[model samples]
Target: MALGGCANAWAAASSASLPFDDIAGSFAKNEIVELVEEGVVNGTGNRKFEPKKNVTRAEFVAMADRLLKLAPVDADMPSFADVPAKSWYYGWIEAAVQLGIAEGKSKSSFEPSARITRQEAAVLIVRALKVDPGSDTGSGLDYKDKSQIAPWAAPYVQAAHTLGLMGGADGKFRPVDAMTREETAAVLDRILHDNVWSKAIRQTPNMGLQLGWQNGLTTAQFKEQVKNSAVNTLVPRWFFLEYGSTPVSNHADPSLSSWAKQNNKKVWAMLGNHSDSALTHQILSDGHARAAVIQKLAGYAKTYGLSGINVDFENVNPEDRLSLTAFISEFGTSLRAAGAVLSIDVSPDLGTDWTEAFDYEALGRYADYVVLMGYDEHWDGDPVAGSVSSLPWVQSALNRMLSVVPAKKTILALPFYTRDWTLQSGGASSEELTLIQQGYRIRSVAYNRSWDSDLGQYVVSYMRQGSQHKIWVEDGRSLGLKTMMAAKRGVAGYAYWYVGAETDEIWTSLSNAIRYASY
Candidate 1:
């Protein structure tokens, strides 16, 4: 019965049929033939796939190279002792290593023919697709019985299991067992099925894709878009009502307001982060109450013609995080429910210290979007050169965050401003000078790159004193790279810390690389 089923399956998979009994009667035989035909899996000497034999790492890679149709840019092999250039699989192994899809067990050994375990095969498939194992679904087969599977591979195992790719005969995932040729084929078939090869060939372009948090229209428009589109857009952070105290001058700059209106984007108001109830009262004290704060904010947004409001209330007491979350939740729900969108910008470490005073997950659910204020490694305090948010740090934050908030609702924040700290006694104090009146002849050394935590920007250092003082400013290269990274990560979109602070080159690079260049 299994033989008949195997033959039928093989026939279904290929355009040509193989001899029914030559090797077809063996379940493993058909799989080997199918894989060989697709050029994804191969056999040993004499055209024998050695069905029922153990598959090794080197042989597996050779198959994968042929299957995935990967092209090596160069033929150079860096000489691993176990995988010498003389080895037939050398070129294939070298290409896999360069692509970061495979690595040797030691500095000089690839263990090419060593039996590959089920978990190792999972890693290969996941790595080839550039899928971060950490980002996979947390559910799937339980690996409690698997002794050789490491803690780090847990996520990848779960991802594969959840997809129904590979499981054990007894309902457990045997991560350490040497994978048999039949077992390897079964897993490969599942992977090929789940991935759907046509997806790569039928890929579509996203050139006209609108992104970020705002649902350009109210009521039905937002409802329909939410149901249909795979991508969404988000608004960046802002101090909507705190700008100027006048009737409507207090909103975002007119140019920005107009840009939002024209582009179908939203705005995030920085209301209570720096505002106290006293400060909130002060806005009302001038004939406007807390209601005035919300009203003036809504009115100005409506007047300037905005699509939404983003609330940025940072450093509230830990106890206040919930209260603030509730307040913003109600505010966002009410405002956006009526049509306009509402978003919130919380601190990077929102899940930990009292400083992280907001329920981001809750806010993510309530607000139209979640603007993760992902910068601020060095606040105004640190004394060193670093990226505002390095890749590892950002990945750590996201790993913790995605647990609660959905990836679709998150928009990573990018910084446009840089800080220049003089190393003198009055160094930090010198920042008190206004952009216009700060003409104190501040000198600087040559430019050096550093990460600015507080402002969430990459800095170019210019020494102000004899090795004592320095100023860090944002450059175009950093901004350009950040934009590209955001797009690659499938985030809703990116939010610049402040559009006004952006230099011409920064804007040019961003627009060319990320924004509407054809416009």
Candidate 2:
């Protein structure tokens, strides 16, 4: 009989025959069929599913075991007084308990024969998925009997509802009511086919750009240029800290926000500290100051009709690492409640004084998107000259970053501008130049611009004022290659360091490159 039951379980999972006769033309017929095909649901006996029968705790455990492909536990039999060692559900119940997907009715009583409730099933499924529903007590549920849901199971129920695993009837979520076989099958089918995490990972590509307030571009010009580019999100420098405790607005160009809304683009208010270590440490180290900053940023997002806030606090002290993490966590909670996104920008991992303070893993967990400043391989103050962002350098940095953060939550920040270094006697002083400006300077000097395959950029060397000037150009070709690299790595998307730094021709090239790459 045990062998026969095992054979039936396998057949129910692999065979497509309609074993349940009563489910024909029922609302859950298709779901029942799929679950049977997936081996997650089996008939009670003699090829009969008993669709309307109440599912028992043991039966639900068996279904969860099959659906999750959980490994069977090989320990001594459970001490539940009612569950005998030879029971058919003994192995599955033990496995479920080991996986933390289910618990006994009491320390000594499993009550395996008792009917399972809707909320109970939800809690089991939530535990199986290993999702953190957080500590938000209020269920955003609109069900009439939501108040009756057990406090411990509220978050799980809400999570299951959000994932489309369960639903209510007649504006009521009968939390304590027994779940039927058909309902259980439907829920399992949804869990198998509709994964919420995978859906979030494959969401729309988010191409963005940071706009400096001092870029000197008018609203009309900004709109005309950005609308034609592949930018979907615009982070304009708008707010900063006042005395390290309050937020002050720079008030972006009035027309910028309206234009973004009309063009189906989102504007995120940029909150910057401009590398002020003292100010950043002050606000982050204080609990009240951190709360004030979060509140003020949320208020700004609401007042400006912005989609989110871009946190650009740089040059943070190493001691403030935990404090910064706390601020981001609290800030993220507030932004989530306000229906806004939270994106954070961090420097590259170079083991330098500036980048070592950031906690990449914590920021990845708290922020919707973690933007890596992937440029400035050789900054303006560097002693030696190198590519602004070489392909090898950026790739190495990305690999280091991915070790701590997930690719789906990471964004690569590319530079639209390059640096021109002048080799002088005392020290090398470099000037930041755009792609257009670099091209113009090269042409004016009539210097032969050659492609450096290693750097993936163009290089030009000329002698002016008795000093050798060299520049590694970031034109359309280099930008396209970097964008493709980001896409191939399966990252969220790429963003430009700032607007008004690239030529008109580069925009079309970038748009085609990103669009064709299917990012």
Candidate 3:
């Protein structure tokens, strides 16, 4: 039978054996046993893996050819003038040539009968996988006769040498020596196990060392794998507005701390609207008030191991603009110096000089992040069927701010809580009832916008009078669209003003949208 056909037939019928299976016996039985047990070599027919027979050069070619599973090209066998279509090893020779594992001794001439040397086998095995034959430093492996290897094969020989697979018998590489069947099988098996072919086998490292073991990964690869798996940024936002006179009894709660420390989450201790007039005045009058706040912030950061801080002070006087600026500049410098993140909520005023109550430009320069408070355009005081912040109005405000502030530092704030208004006979009035008291109905919330020709801006639609129906504001769907707009604008990220007041559905939807969002 042809060698290639025999190899294939043998391979098709072989059964896998455990690595530790017993094989000691007669030479023929041992050859078959070891070959079958190691799954390195195979043979033809009934449970036979021809053990003691001297492997022919063509047979070696056929065995190595099976590793690649390459298709034979449609061509005549030209390895040797003696080789013919009827030759027993024709198919194997064709496959070896196709895989570049074996080459002609001369053009159209393969020395099929020549004994394959160990050096020749090494070169062929490395070449089959396109392994780089590196420079001849003669430095790595102290193989005594390394200088005898031909310059063309230096790299391949060096790689095999470094891999500890090429120390020759009798303590010498014996570069020019021919190989025995046993030597060939050992080297070929090692090469196969190392090259990526035996991925499944090598993945089973020291069985107990399950902490880190993967296909073809060295210690460096293993360390890098762990590091890469751990790579993530923690970006928690502390609802600064929420912290107040209410004592936080849950500070020791693991769930709260866990949530804060999770990747892309953090705590922001709310420097809320100071009900204490003394503290409020302290922020305005004392030049060192900023420093005091910075000290307080540093303490907070260290205490909570916080990722950052967010300032949510509301109703500060117009006169405090410069104080606010100085405070922010110093506070930002302190936080950044301490390697903490800082974000601030700001009044959404488009006009630069129109409102000096809060300096947007100065705040932008000092804060790492600035959230545009884009709600409350119409409130309990103003009875109008209009959006809290219309698209055009938001766009206009954004354009004006972009003129002064860097785009990346901005986070478009989407209001989680919507305002409800009562439609009266003559006009509309803001509903005094809290959102939860309204029976949790969300469809009543109309996300409406219309172009106002006179104002030349899109106006939000809300109930203004009788029969127009009270307007319930934004929900997740509307907020998601706004978040997309923020992402498209390349803002740092979207921020929901107050996550507490938001329903589970709203949180789920918005969180889902921005869960993997990149800044």
Clashes of each: 26, 1, 17
Runs in model 3 deviating more than 4 A are 1-255, 262-264, 275-282, 350-355, 432-439, 442-468, 503-519
* Candidate 2 local lDDT, 1-519, one digit each (tens): 999999988766654457675676457888888878767788877667888899999999889777765433322323366777678887677666543467778766889999999999998888877677776553598999999999988998998888788999999989999999999988877776766533532354344343332245666766766765667787777788768224454666656777788878888778888778888888888898888888888887776778888888887888888998898889989998888989888888888777767889999999888888889889978988878898778888888888999998888988878988898888787999876677677767845455566877667788888888888877666776677677777888777767777766566445434443441
lDDT of 3 by residue, 238-287 (tens): 32211334211122223443543653334454455443334444555567
Residue runs of model 1 more than 4 Å from their true location after superposition = 1-304, 350-354, 383-387, 421-464, 468-476, 507-519
lDDT top scorer: 2
Q: Return whichever of 2 and 3 wins on lDDT.
A: 2
Q: How many pairs of residues collide in model 1? A: 26
| Superior candidate under TM-score, 1 versus 2 | 2
Model 2 clash count equals 1
Ranking of models by TM-score: 2, 3, 1
TM-score of each model, paired residue for residue: 0.45, 0.58, 0.45
lDDT of 3 at 309: 65
lDDT of each: 0.54, 0.76, 0.54
**Which structure among the candidates has the greatest TM-score?**
2
User: What RMSD does each model have against the real structure?
Assistant: 13.4, 22.3, 22.8
* Candidate 1, 24-133: lDDT as tens digits: 54565656666666667755555454557778898777666555555332222233568776677876776666445677787557798898887888778666655666
TM-score of 1: 0.45
